[model samples]
Target: MPEKTTAENIFGSIVETLAESGSKQKSVSFFGEEKSNPVASQFNRLFGRQKPVYNLLGGGKSADVLLWRNKKVSASFLTGATAIWVLFEWLEYHCLTLVFFALVLGMLAQFIWSNASGLFSSGRSQTKVPRLVLPEEIFVNIAITISAEVNRALSFLQDVASGGNIKQLLVVLASLWAAAVLGSWFSFLTVLYVGIVAAHTLPVFYERYEDQVDSFVYKVLQQIQDNYRKLDDGVLSKIPKGKLKGKKFE
Candidate 1:
């Protein structure tokens, strides 16, 4: 036989795997019932018969809207839209330049203060002026950080896929797409700075107003869960299972 190319071999293997799985399903049906998945069963017990994600994605919106009806999706859509509008309408070229210039002035002021107060001269025979961070080092560090983040994301997706929950996968995919759409409207540095600032400030604010914030968040989540429970009982419980197309539903 002529040797198969890499693509041909991969295609052949996929076809073979499908054939084997179909045969196994048939055999199980003829001989005995296939074993049930305990984990899937547990998942069903927790969120089955109900919309896997009922409250948040659903309310006052048609289910036909697909992923757009989600709370986070709406939040992100509005945030992105507002950001773009501000960038195009209110913000000017000089505004952006001045923003960067302000940072430069702040650093210059800090340098002057430190030198005047003998901070840079404390131990050295002569005061040494600090140089700007090298562009190459900055780019290399960013590349390394991005690579690590991508690997971590891939590993997380692999673990979730292994769980075999279609609903979970859909949620993850929807969230990622929404985040990417939002990210497209803003620079990575802007997002990073906002995230960093939020990380620094939000904790202190929460700590200061712990009880009130906790109570409010608890009430909102409680309301959402209650709505989910109601919707599940009203509609989702009545839907019957059907065989999935293109494969034997196992």
Candidate 2:
């Protein structure tokens, strides 16, 4: 009986040890998922992106359109853009010619409808045709918005030019160089259409695969930073910088 009781006690202790180890593993995995990598946290803070991509993009109807929250509206916009691009690029249609043709068609339709109604309504009152007058407020609002954006862009450029941020200056220079290269490759209209297409497509794709993109971007940024550091160490640090004496105020 003593031997049997000792064996039972040993088995119970072994089971308890296994249960404790299993619980520890479960706790460790739960906490591991909850905790973010310290390096990733540092990089995220450095990148100054605390909000989600959608929220950073104004988080309204514009965000919804870009992210394709409403498929019908998004598809309609893409279709309209594609049609315009096809007309201008493929059909080689001039803006003024298209405008005049549209006006002529409208006038013809109105003339036929007005005269045909009179001919068919010999014993009845003729139905009134509605006039197609565009609202002045739409044009005014569009002009105002464009002006504001232009002013803001001018202000931002001025700040970047006057500011002492070498990284930002380099980024602006690189972007301008890229734009120049792209301009050499494609016409302005083609570039604009491409930009519109990219704006419609890239945002939705990025939103769908945000985590993978973020991970890839983080890796790329790290590599770029390391290369920049090496360049600075090898060349930039060796460059002679003149020391300026502060003016004395008596």
Candidate 3:
């Protein structure tokens, strides 16, 4: 019971961490406020609200090198394994048509959700739902769903990590689902694999860029401070100390 509780806590922490990471990504748009630097402003204008994860892929062959270095091979191997598992299980289910139909339905649902969420517009809209509510509510719901799934995935990983009664069969089943729904080839699985691999690799790239941003902002602040200091010492020093026409000097 104690072990189980400990495991649950760890799992919860992982979920919270993933959610926080995702939320941080979501906040890139907010960082583009009027007072923010020009680069951030430009970035916000260019990407609008949704910032792509690959934006972290700093640049060039180095990024590619990092991806391959981190998780490309493992993700590919898992994908291939998942594909085989999916094929074997698909023979049992024989529900390709139903799956495709469901996929279309899901796509339609997503389209509706996206539209209703006002992700397509600014805060104001003449729709049934409140304009202010749309983006925040939808994003909140999405975040909850994502956090739940991530929690489940993290639990699975934790079990494997701790050498607990790891369910190979369940893993195989999940792999099959991944391959079937997401696809084994250039599909969801491929994209997911790329994303995970990129996530592991691209932070280094992003950190460097982040450091540059920090330095730039520091320089800007430093210049502003110097200007303020100069103005205080020179111009402000020359101001008359006596009472003015309409007001007494404090």
- On lDDT, the leading prediction is 2
List residue ranges in candidate 3 displaced over 4 A.
33-177, 180-250
Models 1 onward score TM values of 0.38, 0.73, 0.19
- lDDT by residue (104-169, candidate 3, tens digit) is 997787668768777656687624442333568889899998999999988867666576545765
TM-score of 3: 0.19
Give the local distance difference test score of model 3. 0.56
lDDT, candidate 2, 76-151, per-residue tens: 9989988998999999999999999999999999999988998899868776988988999999999999999999
Q: After superposition, which runs of candidate 1 have C-alpha atoms over 4 Å from their true positions?
A: 1-146, 165-167, 184-193, 239-250
Report the Cα RMSD per candidate.
Answer: 21.7, 16.6, 28.8
Cα deviation of 164 in candidate 3 (Å)?
25
Which pairs clash in the backbone of model 3? Answer: none
Q: For each candidate in the order shown, give its overall lDDT on alpha carbons.
A: 0.58, 0.76, 0.56
Instruction: Give lDDT tens digits, candidate 1, residues 1-250.
Output: 2223433554565566556655655554456566434454443332123433324335354331223446565456546755754664557335577689889997988778657757556775655556656679889999999999999989999988898999999999898897898799976656664664454345445434333344334444555565556555655665687977796788
Output the better candidate (1/2) by lDDT.
2
